[model samples]
Target: MLMFSEDKGKVKFNKPLYGMTGKYTLAEGISLPYFSSLLDIDRAINELRIAEQVPASLEAKWSLKELFQREIDEKRVRQDIVKGYLLDPKKLKFFNAITIVLMPKGADDKILDSFENDSTIPPPTIPWEGNDVEDGQWNHPNARIANFGGVQFISIGLSARLRWDENRVLAVAVDGQHRLSALRTFREDQEFGRSGSLRTHEQETKIPVLFVLLHPDAGFLNVSVQANYSIRRISRELFTDLNKNAKTVDKARELILDDKSINAQCVRTLLTESTTEDIPGLLPLSLVRWQDDFNRFDTSYYLNSLVHLNLLVSEILELKDKELRDPMDKKQVMGFIKSINDALGINGQEVKDGERPLTRYYLEDCCEDEEDPHTPFSRLPEHYLDSAVEGFIVNFRPWLLRLLLDFKPYQELLAYARQYNLIEGNFGKFQAQTSKHKNAILQQENTKDSEWNKREILIPQSAINSMKENQWAFKAIFQKAMIRLGRIIGFEVRSENKNLGNIDDFLNFLNGLYDKGILRVDASLPDHSYRLWTFIALNPGNEKIKVNRAVEDRIFSLLRLWYFGTRKIQIDTAAGEQILSNRKLLQFFAADKNRVHWPGCPEAYETLRKGFDVATLYRKDSNEITIEEKKELVRVRFSAVLAAGLPVLSQLQRGALHEQSSEYYNQDNES
Candidate 1:
């Protein structure tokens, strides 16, 4: 086995990158443990032709039968959607082969040198709302993909440290990259102006990242990493020299079935190992990590970090007192982390296997790199999280889950491998992306790690729109608002009654308060007006005055509804789980400290005075909300800045205002 110290540096690889550890075909003077450098990554990649072509030349020319098979396969492929136009027997000669003319020296030399200093080549993403383009270059003129990350241009680069024994050449920008060709087409177009922007120029506006070659190769070489124009996964020879140093998911694994606890008989009884409470002793479990079998490399530095999490858990739980048994505090640690999601809240997310109280869709991002044998998550102490009762982690579960869980509403994440699969399932090219990975998900950790680690986060088109519309603002404003409100409402309100159905019911309760004499002030109007009252309370212009009847009904109703009927989610995190009341979050805005008469026109409150006079319904049909109404609601949901001031409107408030025109009725009718 290649020891840690001798491995040079990290070289990424797809699972099972090369054959076995020792199996590799290096033509002529090709070396093993070749290190990559700034000047060599691209060179090493293009050099594969020498290793492969030289070996292929020695093989006898294809026999008649072999040639016939190749002909048939080509014919069959020619009729498919991807190649029907190219494989027509007429184009076959021109299809598999490309004519190459040596560019008289100095061609593109300037462009090549410019890229040398800038290794990070952020190629243009296809804008979803691609506008018009000339010659079909910038905007994906070909309606092939759905969005950015779908473009098929290959990224040939190197990992350079010590060039001789630790070099790596990666041919990436594959699969998911081409999926967004459609979107990249529009965003890169300088012509995509406001005059007629597709969806008003909502996508990223970046210059198309054209590939540059500083050291240009003149001979015709096959381009084979995922591309619409290339033969998929078909290289005449496997990448051997490049594969030896690549690392894929590779780790130890054990099925920890200790019926006798016999395997652990030697464990020290004096250990009082709290970390292994559920296991009762150090448990035997399969340890796995993604291997670079596809390109070929591995590592142990990843393994050390994993062990640290276990040690941390053990140290925290090793208190001498018997009462402090399990490190339940781990839950507290977990809670401190945020949900890794940028989409809507995870209310409907489900689990395929056992149930974890908080198996959120956002948490799915944490295990994205499970494909890499050395993927950080694959090494996490998950076995500890395996059982329902007090169980020690398997190894590296917590650290990985915590890292992802810490970034709530995914901060425009880049890709991680395992997540790419889940994401593909929802959108993009999910068909077959998973490829029987579930059973393999846990079983082949060492096999899939490299692919999992390379994925970057694909930001949602909708979120990009929000940022664009808000001048680069994010929805985190709501999160801060939620946090602020959650802290101020005493977290729990006391009520004499329960059974409130929803926010609407809470509003009705406040209305009920006004019907009874318990609420003072403007009792001239009947039914609670919780929406209007709360707005008045929170509105900066409206200060805390004596309890007015207009607000009394709503306040009483809100108190009754939240104190007794409100339900809360038990947010589980590494810091442990806590039952949080959302009602408290609403109260912060309505608190007395916020009531004032400074920010806006106080005249807005006088709109309520018209309610007593305008109590009669002039038009009864205007109040109805239909399916069409709901459709419009959906589009406006993200843009609708939760209007809560006297001028603002909540869903409940809108529903209530739509019911009866309080402004039309006359006060004399009741007396």
Candidate 2:
């Protein structure tokens, strides 16, 4: 509907002379099919989506002027600076075109000459201030990390150069287009010693992209059934609430039917009477599909499964007792599930990611077609663990994911995962790559709004040693929250490894430092802070998890702040007191003592001891979890290292500097 340049000219392309280029493809061939209607359009779009067949013979002379609102003040009185920025392409440098020899599917060498004669005066470079470095420097870590391995680029041909009002815009390849465009444009322009704008700057930037060519009417970034990116905008609080619906449902399930509830005996008869397994809260989260089908799985399905899974698991723990851990860890269960499934080989897709597990981070990587069993998912009991459900969790995920190519469902699933605290590979590692790593497809092109949705990941306590020594009091105060959130273990994080590696890697040293008031780790605010953050991103909510980063930064910052070699007090507090302060010291003591919030009433604790209806909510399952609070709090009071293990820490610190040389023994990537 919108177009800027409609110029039609007799622009004659140079002849394909064998003498001029040593290659001869004079055989005339026509190859352009604008797919029409429902089926044919889909087919045509599908074929052209991947293929780049711009033949010399089929030269449709497009002399249309590549137009733009050159001067910002022209025609449209773009007084609203925000609107101008959101719609500005010249400012964003999102415009790019790939000129490549299009290779046919499964074909090599004999690539069809695509974009052979498509060169125009204005090159397809992202116009950043017409010449600024920041234009291409947008951080899209979730986008393709690299295409064809190392090169952060992708294949994009001249599909369609549609017009938007006064701007020339691209219309196809929604995902990875930015990255591809950046690469193509950078590769096209390079001078000696002078780095031709190959990469973008560091800080993340976002521009509102309007779909001008794809759907002329599609003005906003509306999500489609095909390639959805961001989920509908939900507040961070609401997102957490929506995700925690499972918890609410789970609570209702227990209250209505659990033996500990008021209707202990008669609730079963009142509910289903079928062993009371179909309680509301009990649900397996795997029912959620990876595709945006109308029949999307909800918390209801998850609740249903939990009703049964909980009943079975609770009974199993009572029966198998000690084997089942105090904390219901997925990794342990996954190992158990895999041991049973080792015999029955998984069908469908098999990615050769050598060491990683075969589950989606959500565990839907192997989801299968819904099967009607004798009972609902909530009523299946633990028998499924030895039967089809076991096979489904272990085998079906990979099978189902192979076919769901539509990117939206995956995005939604990931969005949901981040909304809730369910990170870890339940579905498979592929899900992690898809949802968290954000490095799947690297380049500015592959960037999306969902990429920024991950607010932060909670930092693990094991890595707390990496945070600066000045922050120890802070870290100590926050250790309780970290342990509760699985970010830390009270005394030891790496129980087996002990002090075998770098002093930093050793949980004892990490804990000792914290106890000695050296590392200052940030404490998560509340549900509001953790709302949209997944474990992939370590913000304030995950500062503890990225303690290594904090530590690394502190060491370097010290070097810059003070001339090096002058201070021998790497662990000493007096010399390094420039950064630390009395206010933080007070906060540390307050946090360490669990006095951040006034401990007015012991109602929750007393209620638990008295065994009230919601007693379990505030109760600690074990002493190991409860008794270590004081130890962790008092331990991190900072003190200078007396030079015992300084040499080893220095070496480990150096290795960390080189992006390798980890404390973990024999890690493949350790420098």
Candidate 3:
């Protein structure tokens, strides 16, 4: 008999189990022993189950394959582990604890009876004199078992050994699946004599394992009855939570899961509550890719990725890099306010030297830490962090949404998608379709079948290709450019700057640009004389538009000049002055061959001339000059400027611009 006991009372058992067991408290205040043990590599590979192979239980109607565990990469198992770790057994090889959930295969009526009766069974005591106990339980002098508060408690010392019967429980991995897979591969290869240099002793190595047992009262073990909480759902939730908290997880996943980062939390709120009545989210989840951090939006159906969206949110809220990475703090809040004031050109009362600056913006109440002035900004109190996150979301959400929706291209795209039934009005169907599309793509990739590919085609291929060509409006660079411009406009609106126009005026200006084809991929002059996009911001020959700081700044400057003209809003900054005064524009046209013959050049010059007082081509030095002389002078200056800005010939066009000057230079060099 195994002789399992409860509170000094011995109870005989048919099967014996072993491990070092102790209580661990969960979020719901349910305490259970997370059993820890070391198992031989062979036994672990055979006995333990991954999510993909978990057997069905009466409590769970569906399979555990729906868990968020990533599929194991065979190549990684072969190269990084089998070839790297096991091949070098001489070096110290260690593995982290593989977390597993030990779920009962079926309901034990006795345990259910104990829970139903609300039993308070006393702890069992073991006689000190025995080596007569079960083989593994002999060393556990202090081990005791009891049933209280609808949970069975098995208390034992850290060094004590308790038996684990693999037949009675289903052990499914909640974390470290990849490591387990790699070990299984290594074992298989060793058996087949394919493991190059792994020794026989290495195959007998033991790995650390942690077995989590949920409280019996949580209803996870009551397999006979249907309930809200089940082993499948709980285990899946645990898997997701574990990976989401791990440092090795990707940033995009972190943004979706991180509660500590205010920026990330705000992003989640925007995505989840996008269609809510209180907060109308303009950027639907269907239009945003929340998976990988790659910025190749031009090729995908998504307009933006989560990483860039987080960055945009951070920028819009004026969050510092440190704040984005860490928790928001009072010091960071102060800094953010300072930045806001600077953006709006709000110069508060000047402070004297050697004194703290004036608090121009309202500061939220927070407990002050006087002990350490340089305490980490992330260490702010919980209440303060909560207040900060809530305040930011409430204040900035409307502005951010309006800014995104006000952009002409975004509005047009939304309307078009809605018209084609590609997106739902309330976004409910769109989200479901997005999830279906993602799953279909995954299935297609995994199966390598064209049938799966058909299911994955949510959007028409022709439409996708057209969107790719017209991706200029949806590119990250373009979105960021709009955000930067919107930031200025938002500040002007909030500060009630006189030069700031109403929403209608802003809309009209954007619509005018759209109508002129300036925002299109093929934006150019009427006769295809010159590419207007090239003259403005885009590189001459690039296919995909990338994030270029210089290019973005140029775009902002040009838009500000054209939209606001030479008013105070346009010429307030040095950059604005340079563009509006025609100095920078003239220099740009004179230097860049691509801009001299641009159709907008003359209009731009005329705008500058009207905005600022400047001399014409004719000099006022000689009054004796005739009207024809003035005309000749004007023509000569125009011809010289045009000639200076002419494009240089390519190697293919080498003899295309043949000139006598070039021939004379050649003859002089030969002589």
Candidate 4:
């Protein structure tokens, strides 16, 4: 028991708290015990002010936000300590230890130097007096020690004298702020105060702490910081050096998980503990601190990569405080996680068997030395993993989904057109020709088996999986696809002319097109078309590509519908699933790239003329054919065009296509 005397300014302890005992000598004349006690915590909260506040003159030198942000997140700190009790009471225990520094006010420079450097110097006189004046006396008025038989308490001061007084702040907090803040806030909250668990123990609660006594010289203010550095569990520089559940990491995670949005939920799941029932976590259950961990060379790459992806999603959906109740939105958001897992080859079986997961592979591969297993991702020579993540989110995920989803309304329109027997000509022949033209370009680029290579009407699985192997290739394909669609659709897509960094800003630009009547939104998938057109037109995937025409690959497979039908086009349901898998249309595009514009070239009209000529032979009335008859002609004619390998529309025809779609383009561009 450590005892504090109210009248005489003395402290006496019979034994260390929790029966732990250790001590260190500062100077030849002075030494302090490694003490832990309930009284220390109570005294720290009531008596201590941070070192920056002490000595008054040093206050201006320390920035409040920069120096003490640990104190600002009080709610998170409170949740951390009480969360164990709240979630499972049986696991509750003292979360962390408080560390305090005893620095007396205005000590002599020489004496302070001796303590600071761990050099020996003679002891000063004691300030405390016992019942017999000669029996207990030690240092100057700034410090003192009193002994009752074998037990002793050393009082090193932050105030003028080694005394306990309300007017003087006595100690400086070196560590364990989260724990202290939680304890203080729990007592203050009326509800928490009434809680039986906290009230049950009261002052009987004991925590372990390490304390250091420093000389009260201005230079020794840094000594408090030194004490903080000495703690072995925290390594502020390298993330790999951090303990599994560091206080800082825990606090950040709790703060993020507190949100309830679907977007946040997805992020929460990624940062949650890996389980056999769910996907393996890309991030640790307890996240690293952004402020400290971000600046560390070891942790910054992966931390920012994950955080930036979350930011991208949140920005697109406006996820803050917004719950996604719409089935479509929910499906899409959840699918985003599933796509990532599939792309990364994440399997629950592998995780349950204790196999190294995909996320760990990338992180480990990037490290400088494979032999040093402790610092898992401490030395990434190049940030390839981060680039891969960015590429997946920006290029493959959104772009692929756009092609699949935007076709919904078109499919509905095509079905309506088919039912009424109002179809004209062999537009299907024109669509197949368009697919050939696009696939030729992809093949030219040496990208075998790509969406373009297969003449895909939907996003391909190869496109999604390729992101892992070559993010740059995916980036190139994405940029090229966008510019091609923009030009083919007659939109003078100027990447440089847009505010293209934020996903939301780019989406707004697409909505402006809808507002202008150049494009239409399938009310069921509101942001689909906006995402599709802008994703390519704005070239949002690759930041390295300047918004220019040079990167555009003239492979506009998405333009097939415009030449084939004025209505929205629909593909077979079986094909849609085989192509899109779990991907949602919102993840891809809102409307068909074909719906926005027609290729204005003479070559396009020429091809349509041939299709019309073929359909004319099958018409009931010379000018038109029924849906069934039109389909038969289209299938036969388009197969012939594909086999014959005729040019669909060359770049030479680009000028003509631009002229044709110019009116539609201008309507939306101006709006």
Candidate maximizing lDDT: 3
The whole-model C-alpha lDDT of candidate 3 against the native structure comes to 0.50
List all candidate RMSDs to the true structure: 27.8, 28.8, 20.3, 22.1
Evaluated against the true structure, the overall lDDT of model 4 is 0.33
Better of 1 and 3 by lDDT: 3
Can you give the lDDT of residue 213 in candidate 1? 16
Winner on lDDT between 1 and 4 is 4
Per-candidate TM-scores read 0.18, 0.16, 0.46, 0.36
Worst 10 residues of 1 by lDDT: 96-105
The residue-by-residue lDDT of candidate 4 on 1-671, one tens digit each, is: 23333332322222122223345555553334444444444444445454334454433433323333333354355443543243334444555666664432223211011222212321222323344343233344644443221223344442212232222113445566556656655655664654423454555665555544333222123333454432112212112222224555433343364332333343443332421111222332212222221211112111122343344344333322233232224343334323334332222221111344434543354223533322222111122233324333433344323321232322333243333322221222222234576556556644654444343322222322322232221233332343334332322222332211222333333333334333321111121222223222233333223333322322233223232221111232324533221011111222234223322322332333233344233535744666555544433333222211112222123233223223332332332
Error of 4 at 109 (Å): 20
Ranking by lDDT: 3, 4, 2, 1
Off by over 4 Å in 3: 1-247, 272-281, 321-374, 379-381, 424-468, 492-495, 525-530, 541-546, 566-671
- Per-model clash counts, in order, read 139, 69, 15, 23
Which parts of model 2 are misplaced by more than 4 Å? 1-388, 391-671
lDDT tens digits, residue span 71-96, model 3 = 66665565556554555544367889
What's the CA error at residue 525 for candidate 4, in Å?
30
Candidate 1 Cα deviation (angstroms), residue 526: 17
lDDT of 3 at 6: 38
